[model samples]
Target chain A: GGIITQTPKFLIGQEGQKLTLKCQQNFNHDTMYWYRQDSGKGLRLIYYSITENDLQKGDLSEGYDASREKKSSFSLTVTSAQKNEMAVFLCASSRTGQDTQYFGPGTRLLVL
Target chain B: QQQVRQSPQSLTVWEGETAILNCSYEDSTFNYFPWYQQFPGEGPALLISIRSVSDKKEDGRFTIFFNKREKKLSLHITDSQPGDSATYFCAASLSNYNVLYFGSGTKLTVEP
Candidate 1:
């Protein structure tokens, strides 16, 4: 069994500010992903990493950047926060690219 | 464009009754389907899944019925309890590409 942990369960950012969300997993998985979930909307992929230091963009990668400095960690950064924006950022990992993904609790963000 | 779609934004069912949620996909290339359950303030978790090769998959009281010819699938929850109240999401992905395309989700409430 393994667990995924996300940091800063809640985040408050000002408009135009930069924010970073971190994720750590102990599953020793080879694939990691970042997704954004808006209210009443399905989750959208932001970025994914097939392995350490590798990155791939997704449908909603315009304003976000991701980093995979180590095999067990992945991070996402919001370049500039949007005013009144609120969403939940999720981190997930899978044993393989096509395998079932395990998700973290998530980090809720509110931009003022 | 939304590649996946779900019917009935919200549904209410009495305890011990059956709750059915429907989902459809636009991409026929998607061969993997997964259903996820999410409670408030938490990340979505994988509930059940089925491959395109199988028309039906069952786990305990949860059953997934797939119609490959129709590009649709349904989730049936029997003997639903209040604890089963949550948002359900249907997602699809290709065998080669591991990124999942998720439906908007259906919010289910089981009344006791």
Candidate 2:
């Protein structure tokens, strides 16, 4: 069994502030993804990496940047936080794109 | 436009009863469908999945019925339990593409 871990379970940011979220996976998977979850909205894809140093933008990557510096870790940065923006960011990993994905606990972000 | 859509934003059912969740998609290229279950404060987990080639899939008490013609699918949970209470999301993707498009989700509450 493998586990995906996300750091800083909760985050609080101010308007225009930059915030970062990190994720690590022990599954030795080849693919990693970042998604944002908002109330009453389905999970939206932010970014994904097929392997180390690879990056791809998704439907909702306008304000986010992602990195896969290492095969086991993926990180996301919020360029500028929005006022009163509250959402949960989730990280996931899969052995291959077509396989089942395992997710992390998630980081809850509250912008003031 | 949203590629995937789920009906009944929320549901309530008693123990031992069957709970059904519906999902539909707009893209004809999507050949894979997966259902995910998410608990409060946690990321979504893969519950079950089906391919467009298969009309139905069963795993323990959970079952997925797929209809290629309608571009729709449904998840049925039999003998529901309190532990089954969670938000369920339906996702669609092509076999060759790694990215998944997800529905908003259906919140299920099972009463004991």
How much is A51 displaced in model 1, in angstroms?
0.2
lDDT of 1 at B66: 100
At residue B79, candidate 2 shows an lDDT of 99
Q: DockQ of candidate 1?
A: 0.72
Candidate 1 chain B, run of 10 with poorest lDDT: B93-102
Give the whole-model CA lDDT for all candidates, comma-separated.
Answer: 0.95, 0.95
lDDT of 2 by residue, B1-112 (tens): 9999999999999999999999999998899999999999889999999999999999999999999999999999999999999999999998747888999999999999
Chain A accuracy of model 2 expressed as TM-score? 0.97
Lowest summed lDDT across 10 adjacent residues in model 2 chain A is found at: A93-102
Which residue ranges in model 2 land beyond 4 Å of their true spot?
none
Candidate 2 global CA lDDT score: 0.95
Error of 1 at A21 (Å): 0.5
Shift of residue A68 alpha carbon in model 2, Å:
0.9
lDDT of 1 by residue, A3-92 (tens): 999998999999999999999999999999999999779899999999999999999999998999999999999999999999999999
Candidate 1 lDDT over B9-100, as tens digits, reads: 99999999999999999999899999999999888899999999999999999999999999999999999999999999999998647699
